[model samples]
Target: MSKLDEKVGKYIDAVKDTCGLEPDVDLLRKVTAACGPVIYQRDAETVASSDPDEMDRVKKNFLMKKLGLSESDKLDEGIEAAIETYGRSERTKYRAVFYYLLTKHFGKDAVYGS
Candidate 1:
């Protein structure tokens, strides 16, 4: 597999193992593609849930802009729900998997053409 495809596979495994959910493989791959090259970088590959700036970026960039969601408390709640589902104790919360959870959580699978 290509590197991106390899990463997507890993993210898929993470969702199944860490989040206890059977992810839509095609949707996860598309979400991971949407994430771009950040997935290739070690530090940027994972999300720091404790960082406010990162959380804001996720809300603004991923949730609102990419997913075409409006600003609301539900957005924040969705982030929290993804974080909670990913396990707060888990340090390496892969961006693809996290975004996949958020997409699934908000019923935005249509955004990824799921």
Candidate 2:
């Protein structure tokens, strides 16, 4: 399996364990689609960047610090905290929303990768 697949699989497992629900990639994709642009625009504005690569780097740093994710951090806690802080409790699940911001932070190819 590709590294992206591995990461997704690990996160799927983490979500199942933490949230007691299965993660649907399709649903997650929809969530990403709905949220990605706005999140990127805002984050980019925060760092005053228009370049994708620069935005990605800055957003990555911001997310890690904001979400309290260290180098060894797993998806579960970070995602949960994000939902608590930034999500709509009625419609949000950490697993479904995180990939969008992550994609913005790593570039458009982040999900499937280059």
Candidate 3:
């Protein structure tokens, strides 16, 4: 299998063991691939920003705009809340939410290694 497939397979297996449900692998791959550009853009923005708050804002804007959730008041507000709660040292909550959204749309087997 390709590297993307291998990573997706591992994710699928983990999801299966945790959720006890099979998910669509093809959809997962598509969503994962779609997320790549967003991740890259976020990384670039983070590198460009010297201030942590500025970096967080850039990341939030990217997430809101790219995810087509710009109008989501709850998500927008929640992101800020999460950032405050988690502080600048880590972003586990945000990452978890991002992965959750990806898996929700693409299934557990979405290929992301490529």
Higher-TM-score candidate among 1 and 3?
Answer: 1
Candidate 3 matches the true fold with a TM-score of: 0.43
Q: If the candidates were sorted by their TM-score against the true structure, best first, what order would they fall in? A: 1, 3, 2
Off by over 4 Å in 3: 37-62, 71-73, 76-114
Q: Residues 1-114, candidate 2, lDDT per residue (tens digit)?
A: 854454455545544654455656654444434433343343421222224564354345544543334454444344344444333343322322454444333343333433
Clashes of 3: 4
Q: Which ten residues in a row have the lowest lDDT in candidate 2?
A: 42-51
**Residue-by-residue lDDT tens digits, candidate 1, 2-97:** 998899889888988999999899999999999999999999999999999999999999998999999999999999999999999999999999
Worst 10 residues of 1 by lDDT: 105-114
Candidate 3 at 20: error in angstroms?
Answer: 3.8
Q: Give per-residue CA lDDT, model 3, range 1-114, as digits (tens).
A: 875565456545544544344655665455445545443344431222235675465446544454444445555454454344334344322232334333354233323332
Which window of 10 residues has the lowest lDDT sum in candidate 3?
41-50
Question: Each model's number of backbone clashes?
Answer: 0, 0, 4
Listed in order, each prediction's TM-score against the native is 0.97, 0.30, 0.43
| RMSD of every prediction | 0.8, 14.3, 8.0
